[model samples]
Target: MIFKNRLVMFLKRQCCFCGAGFLFAAIAFTGVATAQAGSSQPDVRISLDQAEQMALAHNRTLRADLMLISESKANEITAGLRPNPVFDTDAQFIPFFSPSNLNSDYMDNSAQFDAGLSYKFELYGKRKARIQSARAATVVTSSIISNDERQLRYQVATQFINVLYAESKLRFAEQDLATFDKSLSISQKQYQAGSISHGNLLKLQLQRLLFQTDVTSAQVAVVQAKDNLRQLVGFDSVPQNYDVIGKLEAPQPKLGLMDMEADALKSRPDLQAARQLILQSQSQLHLAKADAHPDLGTTVDYTHLAGNNDLSAFATIGIPIFNRNQGNIAKASAQITQAQEQERAAEQLVLTQVRSAYARQQSALQVVDLYESGYLKEAQQSLSISQYAYLRGDTSLLNFLDAERSYRTVELNYRQALATAMLSEQRLEESIGMSVPSGKVH
Candidate 1:
């Protein structure tokens, strides 16, 4: 009976252990399946505005630039802070080795304890100059950060357009492939019916291969464009497929060239930053001049000697005979000249950018209009008519294929032109440092 009980207990324990192990395995499998499902979920679709917002929020470089503003503000705070007074204690002329001369009292004749406090005073408005210089530096840093943000916005906008263009190409390639598949199907039927020669059927198959190659290349291009956008938006991984939802058409700007140039000079962050640099240089020059004047230090001391208390005050001043910050003063003045020249150069560069982008924008608009107005419609109709005629045995396969290729090329070119137009407009906005009102598209 005891052996039976022991065997039964062992069997029950083993069963329990096996059940637990199976449960753990099941749980692990469920967890892994859940993870995979989550990972395979579709990507979060985003519009251009959303993408820009995300980039501004998460871009590492922009975040680092923002930190510089804080650092500059901290420097300003440091510059405005008053100098701290120093305290010192000294015990002098103590008769330590001569016991006979040494007095038992703590305040003896041969020993002296002195406590002193000293403070250095800034002269010739040096503190005010230093504070002003620091404030000007902060402005320069802030302007630089603004310029960086403007550039980042431009980058995100351009990349978003590229992704849109790539997606359009992929769609066109897929449609072309479908058309080839239909032709291949018809060719196969004709070949089997002995209505077409083997060589001709082989030629059709080879053409299908060409379209397949194009489809593969388009797919790779789309992936690369998306990857570039992801990096700009600061995404670590994008496992699911996502797409941009926006038209490739350009929004016309209402402002003319002269207005744009005026706005750029007034609002362009780089120009503002350059001007702020000039102000900073001027402030530094003032500070350098102030540094030629010396600081005065005053001290108050209290001493106890042989039970006698004495108080004294002294004043000290620095001599400005040598090293009166001549080098820094000269450098500061030269920096002001450099900053002015840079500001002028920046203005010229802005003008060049605006003119170039405007010209490209006009050219792109013309091309887009030419295609959208008549060329694309004609090519598409030609392809449709040729396809129908070939199906009814009224047209040659070569003529039908040529029409198909023409239509595809025209459509792709139209999309490219639209993308270019939109990108140029974006560049113009970046150059002007502001968004222009949308005008009627021609």
Candidate 2:
């Protein structure tokens, strides 16, 4: 009995140890799993600032333009430096010698050795012109980058909002299908009980099919919109159900066409870049004119007599009697004219676009207000009454279906209005050289 008791006590201690280990492991695993899950699924909420950051980081075209701007800045650094100097030397063999073995005067023992550096100092504001041109180029490049960033931002906003619109449509389509499904079930039951005709049952079935088709189409649209957004953001994989983090609101730009045009001149990067190009061309023109004047190079010639200790230096200056660089100057002048014309054209085009976009924005805003005040509310009320009356057998099937269709149409139109208004607002923002709103979705 004593031996058996001792063994039972030992086994009990082992079981307790095992139980303690299992409890520790369970606790550890639960903590670890909770931590992992939390880290893996961070709430993917992005505000406008976040969107801008993502575009800066991930937008390929914008990034490329940014690199171009950097390159232009780099070139500007090299533009102000002078050209490197060159060293020249020459030698002639004398075949004549004073002794009988060689002639003392064969070829003229006239070899020249020049050891001097010549620099062409741009005397007439030429270098300054070049520097100004380069600075202008840099400005233009920076403006182009800004323009690209704005464009990408607009594209992303459109895709993001369109996704929301499609999702709304899909939700409504699903609801519509569910309603049809319930009605079909009731209709079938009624048909069996001789409460309705076969034609009515068939009609319900057809309505269900149509709703199903709409749902499918909406889903497809969602997929396509997601794909487009992914490409814009340079994402290879699709994101999970992204909710737009901003609410749609009417834009309140308080500027007219002339004001916008002036802002565009100040804000549009392409126009600035074109203006910079003109300056660069002007600089080149100056450079060509300077070239037309014979580039004066002064050289000091040093002569060391062979086997003698005398060293003599002589200075010489060069003048161009031919090839006076007229062609180059003319070409550069023509380029300047071309650049000026292009800048004018761009300015005009921007003005036209700003006016047109503002008009469209105004029209879209009016439509949104009209729908909100009159049409959308009426459609909703009609749909509600039709649904209730149909359920109570106080309305004909045709009337109910018509009302339902009208409600769907108005709902779709409302979503479209929201999209149009948002898109128009974006264009207007672009037109006026305004930055995107920093406001987040409500």
Per-model TM-score on C-alpha atoms:
0.85, 0.75
Across residues 4-41, which tens digit of lDDT does each residue of candidate 2 receive? 66765665665556565545544654564465456564
What is the C-alpha lDDT profile of model 1 across 1-442, one tens digit per residue?
Answer: 7976676566566555556555554465456447546657446778888888878888888998899999999999999998999999999877777766676574476589999999999998998999999999999899889988899989999999999898788778878888779877987898888876555565576566556666666766776887888877777433345667786775664567777788889999889999999999999999999999889999999998877899999999989888799999999999999999999999899999887877777788888889978998899899989988876668887897899889888988898898998898889889888887765433
Ten contiguous residues with the weakest lDDT in model 1: 24-33
RMSD of each: 15.6, 16.3
Off by over 4 Å in 1: 1-41, 192-195, 236-240, 440-442
**TM match of model 1 to true structure:** 0.85
